[model samples]
Target: MFNIYKEMWDRRKMIHALSLQEIKKEYAGTVLGSVWGLVNPLMRIAVYWFVFSIGTRADNPVGGAPYAAWLAIGMVAWFLLNDAFRLSQKAFRSKRSIIKNTPFPIAILPAVQITFSFYTHLILLVVILIAMAFALQTVSVYWLQILYYDFAALMLLLGLGSVTAPLVAISKDFGRFLDTVLIFLFWMTPILWPVENAGPLENVVKLNPFHYIVQGYRDSIFYHSGFWEHPLYTLYFWALVLVLFILGNYLYKRMKPIFLDIM
Candidate 1:
């Protein structure tokens, strides 16, 4: 464990370069260049907004805030977390050759993918901020609360990601399972439909442990409330995130030796 940490620290630059390489390669040979990352997510959000917010009788009216802005807050966070989760799972798959040959820490692979998604998410966030400033009239220092929103989500990702490492490495089927589970979770989460009161699902969602991570994001970014405003939710979320992180670290360390062998 100590050695892995030391290796990661020693190879920080290499990891960052790999992350940049991934982003560039993903957009390489395309005429639009880096613009494709921004454009692709924007298009997806547009289609989602068109279908759910416009086509259906969903209830996401924000009183004065436009539906687009409301949707951006949630979608941006969702995009960040979703992309990180999906891409990180494939980190080992893509770098299988390196893992097979090198003495490098396997941890760097997932970290690299997460960093790549973070870069793209940052670009989308800038676009969202500009859109909100011009269209929604809701851009202000109060919006800095989004920092906490992002922090909480990253914590959840780190915790969830650590746990997924062994699972994904040992079983390629976990990626398919991950996609299916995320799709199911998308419906369970109130991404399109706004929650009026917590409802029956709210109790179930609260127990989900990730529910507050998403809700806290929407609350902080769109609703412009400090997470401390919901002290109970704040405490509950970090508690779950921390516990999972510890357990994930333990499981990964215990299973990692056999993991590479099996892979």
Candidate 2:
């Protein structure tokens, strides 16, 4: 695990360059170019705000903040995670040319995709902060917890991408399966809806790692709670992350030698 991360650190410059290339390539043909990255998420937020807050007449303030504000915080976090999952799964295949020809560190391929998603994530975060300044009217020191949560999210992505990237490379079927799983996870997570009155189900929902991230974002913004406050939940989250890191590295090492053949 350390070696995988060490390689990623050593090749950090390449990762940054490739991630930038990915962002440019994604918007090359569009007239708006990289502006679309900010535009796309803002548009989604606007549509969701209209549908949930205005259309459905569910505009009640949540936790003393506007529903739109609350939704934006959660959705922003989810967007990063969803994009990272989707892109990182195909990182190896997307850069197959480099992998096939050069002696590149295949492990960093997932990092490249995650880094790309993070660029957009940072932009969306700034938008959210600006929106919060107007909507909430007061800033709390707890907002700094975003840094911790961002680090947590990155670690989770790296761990998950490591495991799934190889699987997707091995079988395109896994990529399709992952899409279905992502949709299911999106609904199961408390992004679109809140989990207020559930009895035992709330505990089950908390078991979802994505829930930890989504809720962490909310906690940072609306709840004004530190991650350390939820000691057991934080412990559970890190324990799961550790497991994933171990499993991901194991899979990467076992599969690295055969990736060229399979691809």
Where is model 2 more than 4 Å wrong at Cα? none
- The 10 consecutive residues of candidate 2 with the worst lDDT sum are 191-200
Consecutive 10-residue window with the lowest summed lDDT within model 1: 1-10
TM-scores of all predicted structures: 0.90, 0.96
lDDT of 2 by residue, 105-126 (tens): 7889999999999997898899
Using alpha carbons, what is the TM-score of model 2? Answer: 0.96
Off by over 4 Å in 1: 1-12, 57-60
Candidate 1 per-residue lDDT, tens place, 54-150, comes to 6884535664456777776778778888888888776777678888998867877777888788888889988887877788655566677777777
Q: After superposition, how far is residue 101 of candidate 1 from its true place, in Å?
A: 1.9
**Candidate 2, pairs of clashing residues:** none
- Give the TM-score (vs. native) of candidate 1: 0.90
